[model samples]
Target chain A: MSTSTNVRLAGLHARYQFVETVRVPIAVIGTTLFPTLSLLFFIVPQSFAQDPAAATAATAQLAVFAVMSVSLFNYGVGVAEERALPWDGYTRTLPAGPSPRLVGRLLNGLAFVILGLVPLVLLAWLLTAATLPPSRLALTAAALLAAGFPLFAIGIGIGYSMSTKAALAVAQSLLLPLAFGGGLFLPPETFPGWLNSISMWLPTRAGRDLVVTATTGVDLPGPTVFVLGGWTLLAGSLAVWAYRRDEGRRFR
Target chain B: MEILARTVQATRCYGPVIALDGVSLDVPAGQLLGLLGPNGAGKTTLLQLLPGLRRPTSGTVELFGGYPRDAARRRRLGCTPQETGLPPTLRVHEVVEFVAGHFADPVPTPELLEQFGLTGLERRQSGGLSGGQKRRLTVAVAFVGRPDLVLLDEPTTGLDVEARHALWDAVRRYHQGGGTVVLTSHYLEEVEALAERVVVIDQGRVRADGTLADVRSLVPARRVRLRAPDLPELAGVERSNRDGDRHELWTADSDALVRQLVTMGIPFRDLEVATASLEEAFLALTAPGTQTVALIDGELAR
Candidate 1:
């Protein structure tokens, strides 16, 4: 097939997969509601809402949390479950090759990540004094999406390497630690010295720092970009290795 | 005839278990070949190799004069694995259209569905279909691309009699249009009904391969029964057993055995001669050891 045809097929795959995921109401609700409910129950009731800087930063942290959750769950758990299906195996044998499906899955992940942010963004805007200039907000959104790459890679790695049940457990176990350690729930200003030093190296922390800086004009540490880039490179490599290993194990 | 696909001394192993052992076969274009085998006969393994779903442990498998794994070579091929689950949420037509999008030229969705008796089920989710309905749809999806060759692994497994015939007719239509097909089935009747040529596999080896009558003729041993008080030694009698006054004998030449009985003047009455059915032939060919298989091969060689 020509390049244009392949691209069109990839788009079709993405649209169908997205439709499949959304038809199951629980999947959509589970992905979007968890983070939005967190904001409603925790941040809106707190006295810190009166402070614009703290509230804005808090909202930014939660927004990053939403994106991370969607990326991890949608790719890690989603891919693992799909891999177990015979239909998936059949699709892998098609002449169109894996690139179209891979492209489609990535696009689907991005769509869910954005979907997960909608509720959180609406609640944050309505309930708190948290605010950002439209241009800054757009920059922050771009930064958040960019920062999601490493997490998406990690999710793909988990999805490809483990069985569905194991992937679910791993994704769940990784979520809270990464969130807390990255100062998503509580800003890095409050962590003890050792924890703060360790947080600087984590992908989540790197992503959170970069997005927060983009949103609030906070000065980012010198190593944030490098840390994010390194994780993306490492995780991307792991994902590829896992995918090939899976193909070898199942098909060869 | 041109060969569309072939495996030269292909061997496949799942860890220590040899699923297919030193097996070689050629699939010619536009032939509807039935793969008849008991469970664990490596039938599924052979089908998987053709579509590049699994590579042989050793030896070469070629499709369209290229490696089976090559995407370009698979363009003309369609396949349905033994069992598959469709996405629960997608309507039947949606699934067909999604697969059709991959091909340059595809059968129209409505036409394909109608051919498979899935016309009214177009808007229904696959998860809502009955077992037979789901099976029909699974098979129907393979033809959506209008592929030149289709590998169907037990395509009508869970269907009722009516549904199975529907699927068979659909397959026949494809074959009549010059499409090549290789299907595996536990139903001898199915093979007898649809296949022009049959290949019987057992214990990871090809036990028999020929036209329907040729395979049935592999075990030419006939069963002869008679009532007699005394019997003379007979030529061409493979084995003999006595049950009271009634003697039973197995021989390759029932006519010669009968002649010997009459000439010997053994006071025999109520004599009966019966040829083996295809089922019996299959069992004889696939029997536990290499004895029957070796005999058949020797006969074929002669």
Candidate 2:
């Protein structure tokens, strides 16, 4: 196939995957609802809700958590469940190679992340003291998307390496701890000295810091960009390794 | 004749178990070949090798003059595994369209659905369809790409009698259009109905390969049924089963056995001589201690 056709096929795959996920909207609803509910119940009634800077930072953290949850459950558990089906096996045998399917899956994950952010962003804007200039809002959205790579890669790694049940358990076990340790639910300033130091190196914290910097123009104390870049590289490599291992074991 | 697929001394092992054991075979173009084997006989393994879904532990598998693993070569091939699960939420037509988009020249969705008797169910979700409908759709999807070679692994395994016949007609139409088909089934009658050439595999090895009649003759038995008064003890009868007043005798040569009865002036009524069915031939050929028997041109060559 020509390069253009390959791209078009990938687009078609993405469309089909999007439609398939939307047809059963429960999973999407749950993933989107959790973070929005957290913002409504936890952040909206607090004193932070009256301060623009504090509320913006908190909203940014929750936004990162939302994307992280979507990536972990959607890609990690979703891909594992797909692998258990015969349709996945049939699709793998097609001559289209893995690019189209992988790209399509990534697009699907991005869609869920965006869908998940809608309600949270609305709550932050209407009820809390969160504020962002339109340009910074766009930039923050872009930065959060970029920051999603490592989370997406981790999800893929877990998905390809484990069964659906195992992936779900592992993803859940990792998500909350990463969020808590990364100061997503609690501000890093209040964390114990050791946790505050350790959170700087965590991908979740790096992502939250990057989003906060983008949205509120905050200066991060740590090398946030470098930390995010390094985690992306590590998680990306792990994802590729897991995919190859799965292909070897199942297809060969 | 063009050779679409060939396996040369190919053996596939799943850890300690051998699924295909050094089996060499050829699938010529424009022929419908049936691969008959009992359960755990490696029929699925053999089909999987042809589509490059699984690689042989040793030797090679070639398709369309290239390696089966080649993507370009695979473009000309289509296959349905023993079990297929369609995307549950998508309508039947949508599934067909999605699969069709992958090929350069695909049959239109409406026409393909009609061919498989799925026209009325086009709007229905695949998950909501009956098992027989799902099976029909699965088989139909294989032909949507208009592939040069189609591999169907037990295509009508769970279909009712009428549905099985419908599928047979569709397969026949495809074959008549000069498409090459390699289908696997444990049903002896299915092979007998659809195949001009039969390859019988058992215990991960090809036990017999020949035309349908050639494989049937390998059994060395004929069924002779008759009703007679005061039947005599016959030396030529290998075994006899009595149902009602009729005696069914298994013999090497029914003609000779009948001649002996006539020469003895025995009065027999309602005499019938029937050749062994493919089921009997399959059993006799795949029986223990038979080893690998390859019949070339109606003669046992190996």
Candidate 3:
């Protein structure tokens, strides 16, 4: 848990320590979202323009999907590929072992968290007819980051547990369901009773709740933030375990 | 340091196949140990235990007086593993710098380049170099931190006679600097040049450990090839070959055996004594446990 040993960090010495991982994958997530979200907002708007409220909600739904695409899908693939590189092999052999190594990765993850959120914020601003309160925008970003942290951990775990192909599949399959149940796409009040009740504990629900509260001055109870933080912590631990497991088994 | 880089005891079984059967040996620091086993003889597996790259299913491996955890310990060790790997796009200076960054007092780049004959190639990328040049570059990195101990498993994998001789000089310089070198190679000459002491490991067990002359003393000295008009059958000899009137006798000591043959009035055409080489002596030491008796007869059977 505390990787404070003085093992040297070898092979991959990055110039920008905080943003190394973000440097590559953020471009991947950002570019992928640009075209997809752009098409949804510019092209599909004609279909739902008659109902402005529906259009607004649909645009909001698209932004949530973009978050899912990058955080869970692209981030998982990036982390897995990094592990498989021989550069990582050289890094481990260094005298100052895993201590400096994990620090680099953790710092990089937080940077990506910021990189991943920026585009979604800009898209949210562009898609809304009447700007949601600035306070709402700020809350939405914070909530997305809080919610995404655990999913990033879970994504990293999946990346290690499965082959590259399998990790990608798991990421994509879980994205829609996670977003839908979290109350990002449609209000949880409109969901079936049992589904709405269960959604309260899910990361997506807490994330959407935080965002809604920030935007509309509608706060979900403070307990919701704790549940979301708990998810992130649990997933973070699992990711570390998954990484060690996969590396130990791969001898060649 | 008198510390064991790795020690394996009774380690065995690779899935259902047995790799090391009660194989126990200590790798003392500060000397080159030759892992002298034929293909599938488990030499690679034995070295893998040192860096904590592979775990023995039943034994222990210690590096610098502690259990090996990962490559970090190996980073402190210089192992020219069977595979001398480097990225294609990496320039020679980059490779040196990369490993240098991991250490506190890395060997000076210009000094190492000049010593290893890599001065001009410092600007060149590793992938574009010849096989021998690549091996040289890899060795340069191995000694980057002037590691606690250097383990060279098949060190000169790609060099010719000239380059190998150059490498031997570099190895000697490393030792002269008070650093220890552990070298292993199929080229007995390289082993002869690098290893101050030798340990022959066959089938994951140490068959012999001592100086080259000391181990050579364990096996026979000279092999006698002869042609005689009247050949009295030699008794107690392991093998005798006959072609037409020529009789070639393979024996442990050529001087004593040849004197006896001459005294017997065995008038022959020709007789010559061939001095025992390291390969010859190694075969004899590892011969008994060998499932194939090929090394026993030397080239006679083949």
Clash pairs for candidate 1: none
Which of the two, 1 or 3, has more TM-score? 1
Q: Write the per-residue lDDT of candidate 3 for residues B1-302, one digit (tens) a residue.
A: 48657575747567787666555566565565566766666776776666666677887778877867754555567655222356555677877877777676888998888878889888786668888887887777778887878767676777887878888888887777766666667777677666766666676666666677766655456667777665776654556667887776666766777777778777765677787677776777677655432221112121
Give one digit per residue, the lDDT tens place, for model 2 in A114-140: 888888999899999999888897789
| C-alpha DockQ of every model | 0.65, 0.57, 0.23
Which of the numbered candidates is closest to the native, going by highest lDDT?
A: 2
- Where does candidate 2 stray beyond 4 Å? B81-84, B225-255, B259-273, B296-299
Show pairs that collide, candidate 2.
Answer: none
RMSD of 3: 6.3
Cα lDDT tens digits for candidate 2, B184-249: 886888889999999989888888888998888776569898998667888688777787678888
What DockQ results for candidate 2? 0.57
TM-score of candidate 2 to 2 decimals: 0.93
> Candidates' TM-scores?
0.91, 0.93, 0.73
Q: What is the lDDT, from 0 to 100, of the residue B236 in candidate 3? A: 42
